[model samples]
Target: MRVTELSFEGFRNLHPGRWNPDGGVNILYGDNAQGKTNLLEACWLFTGGRSFRGAKDSELVQFGADYAKLGMTFEAGGREQEATITIRQRRSVTLNGVSLPSSAKLAGTFCGVVFSPAHLSLIKDGPEGRRRFIDSAYCQLKPAYVGALTDYQKALTQRNAFLKQSKELGRCDSELLDLWDHTLAASAARLTAARQRYIHRLQPIAAEIYNGLSSGREDFAIGWDSPIAEAILPEMAAQWLDALRQARRADLAVGFSTAGPHREDLTVTIQGQAAKAYGSQGQQRSAVLALKLAEATLLQEVTGEKPVAFLDDVMSELDTSRQDYILNHIEGWQVFITCCEPSTALKNTAAKVFSVKQGVINE
Candidate 1:
């Protein structure tokens, strides 16, 4: 999927602007703290109806403003689409000019790959972030995956509530707890299996891209830390139910449910050592970039569609060869890049360059 045009209003420091991007490389260059990143963030909202920077929907509205609006046109498989999203303090969202009943209603329409400086922490950060990273990327490829995730989260919440309440009373509603246990375990098993399958498919691609970026100095590997692998989803579900029953007392004492896909993690290794502990800063950045690029490739393979790339200050963080690799090797996929200063990094390519300053742009 490629964004052909974008329009934003009252979003962050951006005033209002309409953009037509190159299908290859589209660069938005400006000084630091300008509205460049805000522009890219608006585009990301169309993909998942959420901010990649972890900002709340209302937070996207400009200071002293009450609302923000986003309208984007994209092309997928030679078909064109126009989507609009409106954000307000206490209001619903409109998709395609109609009101969406829930945020979950905004899934699977657009696919994108976003990069920022914060992604460098993917290797070092806690497991929750990494799981979200993988889950979000894979969810775009399969809508069912998103549905499964939603179900799992709902079940997890119910289970946790049961455990919390049971612990507070010093006695449990065994019947209700049993129902939630089975529900949570079943949903967790499905989620774990999907995650494992994705990791298995993603590892080789990530390894190849990482090797290219690191000049084979690092051997990168990725694995899912799930109790059950791809071979047995149902059996694992049954096992998890048993485990949940056995751990009920401890769970109640802690006032929370534990040990399921909600607590699962992704393990990254470099040269057979844990990257979280052993990899250098530069290695983590390269590995994360490779992982993202692999995600773009995986999306293409699954959907026969290439996701548009919205890179936020990513090139600035990479070495010369890796930067060159991204600029030179990227194919027909549309890319929106934000950089603080102009450089010869993109001079060799044909691009549509926009100068941004103080939320205004000269195209």
Candidate 2:
């Protein structure tokens, strides 16, 4: 898929900006914080209806403004499509003038994969960040996985509230808690299975990329760490429900449910060592890049369309070999890459270049 044209109104520092991008590499060069990332974020919002920088809908609006809007025209499978997003206190998003019932429904239709400086923390941060990384990848390839995760999170919230109330009452609402557990476990099991399947598909691709980047010096592995493993969906649901019951007293004392997919993690290793703890800074960056490229390939396999890539000043972090790998490997893909200066490396690669200065993009 390729974004042909993008327009922004009252979005961040960009004011009524519009551009038609080339299918190949598109470079946006500027000093720090000069609306370069803003343009990419606008594209991302059009695709997925959320701020990649972790901003809420209200925060996407320009200062002193109440709303923000992003519109994009793109091509997928030789057909043109239009997507638009409007941000106020709540975000309203649509595709081809048709309203989607929820963000989960909107996720994979015109999806894009992004790699930014902040993603370096994926390997070292808490489990929540890693979980989000997996969820984002899954959402881009499997819309049903996104819906399952939404239902799982909702069930978790309801279950937690019931557990808190039961603990406060000093008597067990065992029946209600059981009901919540059943629902939570059912949803959680499906989510866990989806996550595990994604990781399984990603493993070989990531390993190959990591090996190439590391010059065969390191071997990489990715694993899913969920409790309900090697079981059918119904059986896994029953197993988790029983586990919750077994942990009831401990959960009550802690005032939370502690034995579900929420406690799971994704572990990455290099040469039999934990990537987060033992790998060097360079190694961590390479692993993150490999993980992202693997995600893009998996999305392509699942959707039969090459997803757009947003690279936020990530080229400077890699050495010559890794940089060349990225620029050369992603041949038939749409890339929006931010740089401080237009490098000779990009001059030969970029299909379009836009100069960004003080919130303005000059085409």
Candidate 3:
């Protein structure tokens, strides 16, 4: 997919103007806090996800403005489409002139993948971050997976709330707990199986890219580590039910889930050592880039349309060769990358460079 036109009003610090980015690479460069990242964030909002920077809806509007308005025109699936978002207390969305109940409804309709500085936490942080990384990408590829994930999360929430209350009561309701456990396990099976398959597809592609990024000096691998093994995917519900029963005591002791999808993690390794534990700063950054690029590749393979890439402040702290590799690896994909200083040498003649300063953009 490629974005042809993007306009924003009262969005963060950006001025009310439209930017027509090149289909290849569009670099938004300026000093820190000059709205470069904000420009990317505005484009990323079309992905139907919340702020990648973790900002709230109210925070997206300028200080004197009561709301934010964002609009974009893009081509995908052999056709051109237009989308607009009006942000107040919540995001109101319109796609192809049809209104959507919520911005979340725009997930599969208009898709994009984002890799921000915070995404480095996918490797440095705990398991939750890795799980989120996989699930978020997977959700775009398969819409049904969204229902499975929602069901699992809802059931997990109820189960945890019961666990907390049971702990307070000093005694559990066995019958009620049994029903809840079965419900939770069923949803967990569906969600976990989907996660496993995603990781299986993601691993090889990511490893290959990491090899290219490292010049074959390092070996990168990804694995889905679950409480139940992969050999019995069809019987996962029953197996998960048993596992939940077995872990009930420990779970109640902790007043939350002790095992299952929520507790599971994606194990990332480089040369047989956990990247989080053994990789250097540059190695970790390259690993993240490989994973994100692999995510974009997977999206294209499954959906037949390459999702736009938003790399916010991703060029910082990388070597010259690696910085160029990020562009080389995604030659055909539409990219919006942010950096403080984007010298003309960073991109070829075909690529577009936009100067951003004090919320203004000039190409």
Candidate 4:
């Protein structure tokens, strides 16, 4: 997918503006807090996800404005298409003049992937971040997967609440627990199978990319760490249902549901060691980049079009060689990269450059 034109008004600290970004690399350079990242955020919002920076919807509106409106003219599915998002009480979307049920419906129609400094948490933090990374990557291609995720979360919440009530009342509801067990079993089984399949597809590509980024000096591998072992849905759900029954007393003791997909993790290793514990800072950064690039590659493989890449302040931390790889080596995708200042790696490179100052953008 390519963005032919993007425009926004009353978005965050940015002044109202319009941009027609080039099909090749587009660089957004400026000092800190000058709306460089905000521009990328605006483009990414068309993907129907929340702010990559974790900002609330209301936070996207400027201080004096009542709402933030964003519009995009993009090329996807072999034709030019349009989408708009208006953020007031919440985000409302219109795609090619057809109002969508919700922003999530924009998935598959306009797709992109983003990477920010916070993505370091995918390696340095706990399992939740890694799980979110894999799921978010898949949800972009199959929007229905998001429904599975929501269903799993809802069932988990109900089961945990019931667990808490039982603990407080000093009473057991075996029948209620059984009902939750069956519900959790189905949702967890389906989600786990989907995640494992995604990892099977992702692991080899990520490993190859990481090896290339590290100049073949380090080996990279990732896997799903899940409790349910069976591969088929019926068998896996049976496995989980039995596990939940077995774990009920322990779960009650802790006032929460103890065994399910929520507790699963994505395991990442570099040079046969846990990247989180032993990898160097550069290695960690490279690992995340490999994964992000793998996401873009797979999106292209599935959709027959390259998804735009938003790399926020990524080059500043990378060494010269890695910087060159990002600035000049990646092929065939529209890339938007932000930095505090341009680097030598950008020298002799053909790219459209935009400078941001005090919320205004200059071409």
| lDDT at residue 63 of model 1 (Cα atoms) | 93
| Worst ten in a row by lDDT for model 1 | 89-98
Pairs clashing within candidate 2? none
Write the residue-wise lDDT of candidate 1 on 67-120 in tens digits: 888788888657887777778865355666677776556556677788888777
Worst 10 residues of 2 by lDDT: 100-109
The whole-model C-alpha lDDT of candidate 3 against the native structure comes to 0.88
* Pairs of colliding residues, candidate 3: none
Residue-level lDDT of model 2, residues 1-363, one tens digit each, is: 899999888898996878888888999999998988888888887666466787776777999987988888998767998878877777777888998765546566777878887888898788888888898788766656767988998998998888788789888777878888889889988988888888989999999988888777889999988777657889888878888889888988878888888889999999989998998988898889899999998878877889899998887767777776788768889999998986667777756998898888887
The root-mean-square deviation over C-alpha atoms between each candidate and the true structure, in angstroms, is 2.5, 2.5, 1.8, 1.8
Q: What's the ranking of the predictions by lDDT, best on top?
A: 4, 3, 2, 1
Could you tell me every candidate's TM-score relative to the true structure? 0.90, 0.90, 0.94, 0.94
- Which should have the higher TM-score, number 1 or number 3? 3
**Which stretches of model 1 miss by more than 4 angstroms?**
90-106, 172-180
lDDT of 4 by residue, 1-363 (tens): 899999999998888878999998888999999999999999999988888999899888999899999999999999999999999997789999999989988878888878899889999998988898889888866768989999999999999999999999999889978999999999999899999988989999899888777777889999899877847899999999988999998999999988889889999899899999998988999999989888888878888888888999888777787777665446678989898878878644788888999999998
